[model samples]
Target chain A: MRAIFLREFFGYFRTPVAWVFLSVFLIASVGVPWFLGNFFESNDASLRIFFRFIPWIYLFLIPAVGMRLWSEEKKSGTLELLLTYPVSLGQAVLAKFLAGWLFIGLALLLTAGMPLTVAYLGDPDWGTVASGYLGAFLVAGAFLGICSACSSLTANSVISFVLGLMCCLLLVLLGWNVFGDLLLSLNFPVPLVDFLASFGVLPRFNPMVDGIVAFADLVYFVSISIFALCFNRVVLHR
Target chain B: MSAPHSTARIEANGLSKSFGEIQAVRNVSFSVNPGEVVGFIGPNGAGKSTTLRMLTGFLRPSEGSASIAGIDVLKHPIQARLRFGYLPETGPLYGEMTVVEFLRFVAGARRIRSVELDGDLIRVRKVCHLEKVWHQTIETLSKGYRQRVGLAQAIIHDPDCLILDEPTDGLDPNQKQEVRDLVNEMAAEKAILLSTHILEELEAVCSRVILLHQGEILLDESLEAMRKRHPLFGSVKIRVAPADADRSLSVFGKLEPFVERIDRQGDHFLLRSRDKRNVSDAVLAVSKDAGLALLEVAPVIPRLEEVFQELTRPQSKFIEEQG
Candidate 1:
């Protein structure tokens, strides 16, 4: 597992994919708040605009990172060699997942400038900024897990990316208020709608962004990541 | 051929695999002992790769079992895998990595740590002749060099057994000879099971040959025993003039007691001998008695290509009866 992690973590930088992802991610992350967001005008001394764009940025970028996780190994015939090693299937999956998550963590670390800039302009709430960063990290893990699971289902990288994007989009849409409202209008019970809405990324993520570290929200993200990783292992085993 | 050791290093007992509804291998069984080089020959789609995958713990067998050094591959995959090295049919290389990086990764994965890793890498590099291209990227290397790297990775762990699928499939003639010699050199220490369609490769390096057809083991015997069983072994050909052809036919029939079989084609007579004795001398004696002129007399050498064809051809009388 350590061997796989080392290979994969360094493999991203060996190609231009890691650089490309970081460049685009940093630009979009900082750019979203500068031009479109009411950064200076709101004068609220917080990083709400930066946290708001986290899920949208993760929805697309995580798939690009995760698409090649298993699809490349399958197409290049290295999966046969990898599986024949002295490691189990679960170990291999965990190694790959941790590598990708750590890569995203690096990208998130680069965006430290956002919160620092807010603190320079005015008295920004440091607690909210810390929680927001934590929230983005958890969401990135959840997104990457789903994308890696999609990667194991196919040998084509393009299809893997598309499937990963669709799954992430679905997870995001589940938390959208309109989706829950639409179900409620069709005579669905209130408890059922609330139960389904609780699984969405937005609901679980909103509290963290607000500096409220709820136990249920942490459990939700951890459970989703675990479920996605297990799905990845199952897909590859078949 | 040397007798196989009682302690088998590689064993497959009634192993079978199926992908969905299509059965790929069925009840195939074989064993390779230490210091033995077994050649696995088969036509394409004959389940050679699938069988190797099962033995190497890459694929699970639907029935029966495969063991390496007496460890069941399915029950204890890590221990079984530690005993053997496998080179899959595709050469399983990470093209983006340099030869050094790839070998280091393989070495680390095989559990050779920092201090001894360098020593192991140097040893494998020397054995595989990879010194010149050690720092070159795998994608930049030629196919022959890539194959050498693959071979180097397989043996880096210095396992007791090795399974190689088409190890020399795409090399040039010289490279092929180099690989053959390398296999021969390695055969002294490791039990090697290699599959190839190249008949001469089997004849050159394999002490025992396993012929598979339609996912079934057709023949398994020592190379010397297989050659001796050929009908053309120790056979001699003779030519006579048209005038002496009729007298030569009668004389040849009388000489059948000293030979195994006689085949007649026009003025040429092919006489197979049962033993190493000179059949041509007896034919000359018969010719002298009949006053027939003998034009040509030469021993015929049986070819391995003919043996492979004879064993793998479809709808043969022997296979039909077995069915």
Candidate 2:
């Protein structure tokens, strides 16, 4: 497992993928809030705009990062060698996922300049910033899980990327209040609509973004990541 | 050959694998012992790769078992995997890493670490002739270097058994000979199972063969015994004068039991035999006794190609029909 992690983690930097990905991620992560969100007009010390664009940015970039997780191995015929290694299947799955997650964590870490700038300029709530970072991290993990599972389904990285994008887009769409209201207006029961809405990314993450670190949201994101990794195992086991 | 060696280092017992309704391998059982190089030959889609995958613990057998060094692969895959080195059909290597980095990763994965890892790195680099391309990334190297890197990783742990699928598939003749020599060098200490399309290479290296056809083990025997099964095994050819052919035939009619059948070639009459024996002397004396002048007399050398074609004819026919 450790070997797999080391290979995958260092693997990202071996090619230009890591540098390009981090560059695009950093620019979009910080630039999106400064231009689109009311970053300067709000006149507030909080980084609400930055937290708002986290899921949208993650929905695209995480797929790009995770698409090659299994697809390259499968297409290049290295999957055979990987599965036959002395490591257990579960360990292999987790190691690969953690590798991608940590690399993304490093990307997220590079954006610390944004929060630090806000803290240095104005009286900012550190607790809320910490909670928002946690929320975004978990959201990245959940998005990574879906992409990893999609990656295992096919040997073509493009197919995996598109599938990952579609699945994550569906989850993001369901999180919107208008979509939930549309479902309720279509004669769906309140509990059933709430149940479906709870699976959305924002429903699980938005509370944490608001500095409300709920236990259930944390468990939900972790479970979603676990479920995705298990799905990765299933596709490979076949 | 050589009494089939001693302890079985690689064993497959009643192994079967199926995907949905199609059965890929069925009840395939064989063993490769220490000090034996077993050649696995089969046509494409004959379940050769599937069988190797099962033995390496990459694919699970549907109903039976495979063991490496006496450890059941399914029950304890890690332990079983540690006892053998498997080079998959494509010889996949991590293209992003340099040769040294990839070797270190494989060594680490094989549980060889620190000081031990350094020794293995030096050993495999030397054994596989990978010292020149040591610092080059796998993707930047040529096909031959990539293959050598693939082989270097397989042997890094110095396992007792080697399972290689078409290890010499794409190399030039010289590279193929290098790999063959390496396998031969390793045969004294390890049980080596390799599959190949080149029959002459098999004859040069393998002591025994396991011929699979239609997902079943058709023939499993020593190379000599399998070669003997070829129809042209002991056949001989005699070139006689065109006018003296019929007279030679009359002279040869007395040796019917020794020569099972004789057919006319362009310039020679091919004498078929039931067993491989010294019948050239008999033919010479018979023709000399009748005063029939002979132009030439030669015996056929049995080849694995003929035996392979004879065994895998049905599949060959299908391929031709498709074309």
Which candidate wins on lDDT? 2
Tell me the tens digit of each residue's lDDT in model 2 across A1-238: 9999999999999999999999999999999999999687778898778998999998899999999999999999999888887988889989999999999999999999988989888988999999999999999999999999999999999999999999988888788788999999999999988888888989878888789999999998999899999989988884
The parts of candidate 1 lying over 4 Å away from their true place are A185-189, B1-8, B240-247, B264-267, B273-296, B318-323
Interface DockQ of candidate 2? 0.71
Clashing pairs in 1: none
Tell me the TM-score of model 1. 0.93
**Model 1 C-alpha lDDT per residue in residues A121-150, reported as the tens digit of each score:** 888888988999999999999999999999
Residue-pair clashes per prediction, in order, are: 0, 0
At residue A128, candidate 2 shows an lDDT of: 91
Name the lDDT of candidate 1.
0.87
> Model 2: per-residue lDDT, tens digit, B292-315?
889988888887787788678865
Interface RMSD of 2: 1.0
* Residue A147 lDDT (model 1): 92
TM-score of each: 0.93, 0.93
